[model samples]
Target: MIDEQKQQDSMNNEPNQDQQTESSESLEKETAAATPQETEVVAEQDSVPEVETQSVSEDDNSQQQSTDTTSTEELQAEIQNLKQKLEQEAQQRETVTAQAKRLAADFENFRRRSEAQKEEIKQNEKRETLTKILEIVDNFERARSQIKPETEGEKNIHKSYQGLYKQLVESLKSLGVSKMRPEGEPFDPYYHEAMMREPSNEYPEGTVIEELRAGYMIGDSVLRHAMVKVAAAPESSGEEENGESEKNNSEEELA
Candidate 1:
C-alpha cells in the first residue's frame, strides 16, 4: 500500500507540472502581442502632439499679423481726423481776422465822417456869428462918418469913438477879416453888387466908378458884397441938340 500511494502521488504531480508549463507558455505569447500594439499607440500619440504644436504656432503668427493691421488702420483714421480739425481751425481763424479788419475799417470811416460833420457845423455857426457882428460894425462906421465934432468936449468924445473903431478894425484884421477896395477896379458880379449906374468920362464902361458900401473878405471868401456904382458910356449932348434943330426946321417948313 505504501508503494501504490507513492506511485499515485507521483502521477498527480507530473500532470500538474505539465499544466503549469502550458499556462506559462500561453501567457508569454499574449504578452508579446500586447507589447507591440502598445508601442504603436505610443508612437501615434507622440506624432499627434507635434502636429498640434505646429498648428498652434501658425495660429499665433496669424493673430499677431491681424493685430498689427488693425492698429495701423486706427492710426491712419486718427491722423485724418486731426487733419480735418486743423483745416476747420484755420478757416475759422481767417474768418475772424477778416471780420476784425472790416470792422476796423468801418470804424475808421465812421470816425472820419463824424469829424467832418462836426467841423462843418462849427464853421457854419462861426460864419453866422461873424455876419451878425459885421452889421454892428456897419452902424459904428456910419456914426463915425456922419458925426462932426466942433467943441472941445465933442472932439474928445469923437476921438475916443474913432479910437474904438480903429481897435475893432484891428481885431477883425487879426481874425482873418480884410477890407476890399472896389473903387477904380473892374466891376465883378461875384464880389460887387451894382447899386447904381453912372455915365463917367474918368472910368471906362463896365468899371466900378465909386464904392457906395465897403466890402469885406475873410480868407479868400467874400464875406460881404461891395455896393458899387458901375460906369456907363456917356450920352452925347451934341447928337441930342442936332436932333432938336432938325425937328424945328421941319416944323417951320410945315408952317
Candidate 2:
C-alpha cells in the first residue's frame, strides 16, 4: 500500500510539470509579438513630430517676406506724398511774390503823382499872389507920371517916392520879375496887344512904333502884355488930295 501511494504521487507531480512548461512557452510567444507592435508605434510618433516642425518653419519664412514687402511699399508712398506737397508750396510762394511786386510798383506811381499835384497847386497860388502885387506896382507908376513937384517940399516928397520906387524895382528884380521893352521891336500877338494903328515912315509895316503900357515878365513867361501901336503902310500924297476934293464936292452940293 505504501508503494502504490508513492506511485500515484509521482504521476500527479509529472502532469503538473508538463502543464507549467506549456503555459510558459505560450506566454513567451505573445511577449515577442507585442514587442514589434510597440516599436512601430514609437517610430510613427517620431515621424509626425518631424513633419510638423518643417511646416512651422516654412510658415515663419513666408510671413517675414510679406512684412518686408509691405514696409517697402509704405516708404515709397510716403516719399511721393512729401514731393507733391513741396511742389504746391513752391507755386504758392511764386504767386505771393508777384503780387507783392505789383503792389509796390503801384504804390510808387501813386506817390509820384501826389507829389506832382502838390507842386502844381503851390505854383498856382504863388502866381495869383504875384499878379495882385503887380497891380500895386502899376498904380505907383501912374502916380509918378501924373504928379510933378514945383515947390521944395513937394520936390523932397517926389524924391522920397522915387527912392521907394527904386527899392521896389530892385526887390522885384531879386524875385525874378523883369520889365519888357517892346518898342522898336516887331509886333507879336503873344507879348503885345495892339491898341492903335499908326502910319509911320520911320518904322516898317507890322512893327511896334511905340509902347503905351509897359509889359512884365516872370522867368520866361509873359506876366502882362504891352499895349503897343503898330506901324502901317502910309497913304500916298495923291490919295490924300483926292479925299480933299471929294469932301469939297459934297459941301458944294449941300449948299
Candidate 3:
C-alpha cells in the first residue's frame, strides 16, 4: 500500500511543475514584443525634432526676404525725393538769374538816359551864358561904329577898338552863334518882342514891319528875342465917302 501511494504522489507533482513552466514562458514572450514597440516610438520622436528645426529655418528665410524687399523700396523712395528736390532748386536758381539780368538791363538804360539829360542841360546853360556875353560885345560894336577919329592919337585909339570888336564877333561866330533877321516876316512872340505898332498900308496886320535890335540864335533855340515893330490893320476910306454921298442925295429929295 505504501508503494502505490508514492507513485500517485509523484504523478501529481509532475503536472504542477509543467503548468508553472508554461506561465513563465508566456511572460517572457510578452516582454520581448513590448520592448521592440517602445524602441520604434523613441526613433519616431527623434525624427520629429529634425522636422521642427527645418520649419523654423523656412520661416526665418521668408522673414529675411520680406525685410530685404522693404529696404529696397525705402531706398527707391528716398532717391525719388532727392531728385524732386534737386529739380526745385534748379528751377529757383534759373528764376533768380533771369531777374538779376533784367535788373541789370534796366539799370543800364536808366544810367544812359540820365547821362544824356545832364549833357543836354549843360549845353543849354552854356548857350544861354554865351548869348548874354554877346549882347555886351554888340554894344561895343555900336560904340565903335559911331566914332570917327580926327587926330593921330584918336585914330590910334579907334584902331585898337575896331580890332577888339572884330575879334569878339569872330569868336562868337565860331561857337555856332548866328544873327536873326525878322524884318518883313510874320510877327512871332517867341522870337520877337513887339516894341511898337504902326498903321501902314504896305504891310498886313500882325506882320513884322521892321527889326529894331538884332537877335541871336544857337541851333534851334532862340538865344535872345528880337526887338521889332508890328503892322496895324488899314481901314477902308471908300465906305466913309459913300456914306456922305447918300446923305447929300437924301436932303435934295426932301427939298
In the range 199-236, model 2's lDDT, one tens digit per residue, is: 66788988988787788888898877888888877767
Residue 36 lDDT (model 3): 86
Write the residue-wise lDDT of candidate 1 on 15-87 in tens digits: 9999999999999999897988988999998899999999999999999999999999999999999999999
| Per-candidate TM-score against the hidden true structure | 0.66, 0.61, 0.61
lDDT of 3 by residue, 146-240 (tens): 88789999999988988988888788888878889898999999998888776567999889888777888877878888888888665467634
RMSD of each: 9.0, 9.0, 11.9
lDDT score of residue 41 within candidate 2: 93
Model 2 residue runs over 4 Å out of place are 1-84, 236-255
Task: Tell me the deviation in Å of residue 248 in model 3.
Answer: 33
**CA-RMSD of model 1:** 9.0
Residue 223 Cα positional deviation in candidate 3, in Å, after optimal superposition: 2.0
